[model samples]
Target: MRLLAWWSRRMLSAALTLLLISLLIFAASRLMPGGFAEVVLGPFASAEEKAEVSAKYGLDRGILTQYWLWLSSAVHGDFGLSMITREPVTTEFGLRLPVTAELTILGMAAAIVFGVPLGVLTAIRAGRRGGGALGRLASGFGVSVPEFVLGSLVVFLFSRYALGLTVGGYVPFGTDPAANLRAMVLPAAVLSVFVIAVTARTTRDAVLTVLVEPYIAAAVARGESPGSIVRRHVLRNASIPVITVLGTVTAYLLGGAVIVEYLFNLPGIGSYVVQAVGRRDYAVVQAGVLLAAVVFVVMTTLTDAVAGVLDPRFGRSA
Candidate 1:
């Protein structure tokens, strides 16, 4: 019963937050200089044409009325026609979302696959010898380098040296899965850097903290093997904090997707949003922003739920 109530509250809060985000997106879109019709039709388009376009899209309506109409349509998954391409916003998002999703998933997977083990090693080494220079240095490098700069360097070295890397442009998975994965590799690597650093550092710190707990010392005194202790005790306790950091890093990576996609010339939602914003394509802009917000919220909520499951104390408090 308590869990149900908590979930209901979280859902209600997420809905309210999304409502606020949608309103802000709508306002910002309307507030952009020169208006949507001017941007879509160009400066030289005659007044009659502009008026017709505005009326066709109901842009001439008052702000509140237009927002109501948009909100209603959006509730039904109809984001309306893009002023620039005359394409449905949902269709455009549908086409681009998968590319972005693939990139994000691969990047996150790489981060976890590499970061957790490195973190565990570092923590173990630190506890044993009081130093972990290599792990510290790697984390420092990951934290210091921005994704764009890292991507640029990778592209220069690989493309100039003829390293057999596809540095830019995306290949669809259906066309050739191997080529598609190869194309995404560099971008995903660049995206994973920060995630790796954050997850490693968080995991290292959490593990170090767990190592000092009396239970750990008791386990050691009990003559348990190091591997058994880590598997049964250390990792489980340490994972809560690591999961929290992963959630935060995942959110950061989604925001960074824009830069990575642009640098790699991937036709993902991030790139599509950039183009739509430049053209003041209201429908696309609103849909893209809303979609991104929804994803972020869902990811965060899931992370919390996972953490709560791992530690029931967290669930009770939540």
Candidate 2:
């Protein structure tokens, strides 16, 4: 019952947050410098033509009325027509969302696979003299490099010189699974860098704290193996913070994917958004922003639920 109540509260908060975000997205879209009518009709278009275009699209309506109409349509899975493409915004978003989602998922998976182990190993080694240096160095390097810079470097080194890997294109997995994976690798790796840094640092800190806990000492005194103690106590406790970091990192990846996708020439929602914004395609922009917000909220909520399961105190407290 308490769990249900907690989830209901979370859902309500998420809905309200999304509503606020939608309002901001709408306002920001309106604030874009170019008039949508001029973009669609060209600069040579007569004032009469521009006026007709604006009125045709309800652009002349009051902001609140426009929002109400758009929001109403959006609730029914209609995001209206893109001024640039003349195609349904929903259709475009639907086509692009999966690619971004795949990239995000792969990046998160790679980060967890690499970062968590490295963090655990580093924490264990830190107990010995002078062992934490390598972890610190790695985390520093990861944090220092920006995603776009790293992505460019990867393209330069791998695509241009050494590996001769393909650069700046995407193949649909349905069409060519092997090619798709190959194409996704670099962008996903670029996306994972900050995730790896954050997860490793957070995990290292959490594990280090757990290592000195009374339960850990008790386990060690009872002749428990290091692996067993880690599995039983250290990892369990450390996971809470690591999971939180993972959730945060995943949310960050959604935004970071924009640059990475543009650099890599991937046809994901990130690139879609970039193009839409450039063309002042307000419907596309609004839909993209709302979708991104929904994904972030859902991912974070699930992370919290998972944490609650792992540590009953969280569940009970709620």
The models' CA-based lDDT, in order, is 0.86, 0.86
Model 1 spans with C-alpha error above 4 angstroms:
41-50, 128-130, 251-256
Measured by C-alpha RMSD in angstroms, how accurate is candidate 2? 1.8
> TM-score: which candidate is best?
2
lDDT tens readout by residue for model 1, 88-159 = 888988888778888878878977899998899998899456578799789889989998899888888988
Cα-based lDDT at residue 228, candidate 2:
97
- TM-score to true structure, per model: 0.93, 0.94
Could you tell me which residue pairs clash in candidate 1?
none
